[model samples]
Target: MHISRQQTESAERGPRARTRKLMLETATRLMQSGVTPSVSEVAEAAEVSRATAYRYFPSQAALVHAVVDEALGPILDWKADVPDARARVGDLIKTAMPRIDEFEATFKAALKLSLDQWAQRQAGTLGSEPQFTRGHRVELLRDAIAPLTGTVPNDARERLVQALSLVFGIEVLVVLKDIWGLTSERAQSVAEWAAAALVDATIREAGNGA
Candidate 1:
């Protein structure tokens, strides 16, 4: 009886793994082309049965969320060696800017839904956790800054971090690319410049009269 059960579990595991792979591959291909492929289409493309696809991901949103999580693997691991504080911050911004642009459309769509969810929560209509939160992003930014600053004062560190947040926001990208009509490369250049300026401005502010 034990041997039979083990064989059955192993059989199920193989199919499950294959289904997961297919779903991910299909979704990524569709999203790369600026289309949100439906579950049936994904299953057809992947040559998996519809039932198998649904078993792996019950809904399109679930598949999309999984794809986003998988796609962010490298960006989520944003740690690199640099020679100095200025270079460290600049390198970090440069590393992140292009990654952010890749998922800009997807993020813009999802964030709109999230904003609506926040409004519902504020009106006492939501009965669940917050839908949109940047607290984690803010914390990560602080962690990245901590190692770069050699001897910045507490106030200066706080000021510099706030400036980093503002300069690194998606709004900056939108303004530079959309309003100003700059190319993506040019916009990123502006963002990097702004981030560098913040670092320099904070250092000067901290040094004045000291």
Candidate 2:
């Protein structure tokens, strides 16, 4: 049976939309279940033909990357309204901890894929770190720690920046969560406690005998 051009276009559009939705849904399921399913498995779970899945997502890697970003979007969005730098840093982590914990497997997979890409790249084509780029996490930490340093001697600003960078940085997140196996909530709580303590100590030291 021959289909009209309009019918063909409509059919194509419906399947394309459904395929995209299926891809995202399947990826989220994989993340929740801690399953590293292949494209074929995802297609089967999504109830789409393998070719249909490939049409929406060119490759499994692309699908996985999109899913991870989607999962992190709400966490990033919540941090936008935070005005206090110190609170923002702590709040950002606290807010993300539960969501991050749930989607931890997805982000971990994405990181592994990114590392593999870096390894395959040429010298000039080397990739940068995706998890720790310029964003709310970095900016918020910088702001929160800035006021902790009072009008000290020269290079005080630089010192505070370096200290905060070392303490509440993205690398800390990876270490606390991945290496130490600390729950996201616990890690954020510890980090916030440390940041608050540093601020208090700085003020106390500056007011010594004054």
Candidate 3:
């Protein structure tokens, strides 16, 4: 009897994994389709019971975060092999921009969730929902600028990271493509140029102690 119970538990694990994957994939498709769906909406779209979906993702924030993480899997896996800080930053921008473009809607939906949470929190209506904080760009920018540590002061490194964040994500896409009406290639080129220029200027300023 105990052996049968153990086998049943093992057998149940596969379906649980499949259910979670289905929920994530469904959420991604919805977000990519330009709808920032709630967990229940995703569950309905996935043909999953709302209860089951909630078991996997308890709230809208959790669901949106999972979708964002899925879309960012490629960028998260990126590694810079060269040691030059400027070259590394350029490489990261080149690698990231294309993927960022590919997942633009997903990232934007994630941003919307963040903004909504911020507004709710400010109004003291945020309740018990988990907060969705954005930090991927912070870590990625720091890594891209890691080779600058010996030459640039820690504070300056942080400032460079802050500056690069301006051009690093879907917000840049909106500024460059939507507002400026630049082509995708042009937008990417501009961002890469800006990133490299920031690295050079930051290093130069540090050298002069300015």
| Best-matching candidate per TM-score | 3
What C-alpha lDDT does candidate 2 achieve relative to the native structure? 0.60
RMSD of each: 7.6, 9.5, 6.3
TM-score of each: 0.67, 0.58, 0.91
lDDT of candidate 2 at residue 46, scale 0 to 100: 82
lDDT per residue (tens digit) for residues 26-133 in model 1: 777777665666678889988889998988777665666666655554555666565455676777777777876786655444444456667887799866533444
Off by over 4 Å in 1: 1-67, 147-150
The residue-by-residue lDDT of candidate 2 on 27-67, one tens digit each, is: 77876676655567788888888887877666656577557
Please give me the total number of clashing residue pairs in predicted model 2. 0
**Superposed Cα deviation of residue 64, candidate 1 (Å):** 6.4
- Give candidate 3 regions above 4 Å deviation: 1-13
* Residue lDDT tens for model 3, 1-210: 223323533675775878888888999998988888999999999999999999989999878876777787668767787889999999988988998899898988888888988999999999999998777888888999998888899999999999999988999998999899998899999999999999999999998988
- Model 2 CA RMSD to the hidden true structure, in angstroms: 9.5
Instruction: Please give the lDDT score at residue 167 for candidate 3.
Output: 87
Could you tell me the TM-score of candidate 1? 0.67
Q: How accurate locally, in lDDT, is each candidate?
A: 0.67, 0.60, 0.87
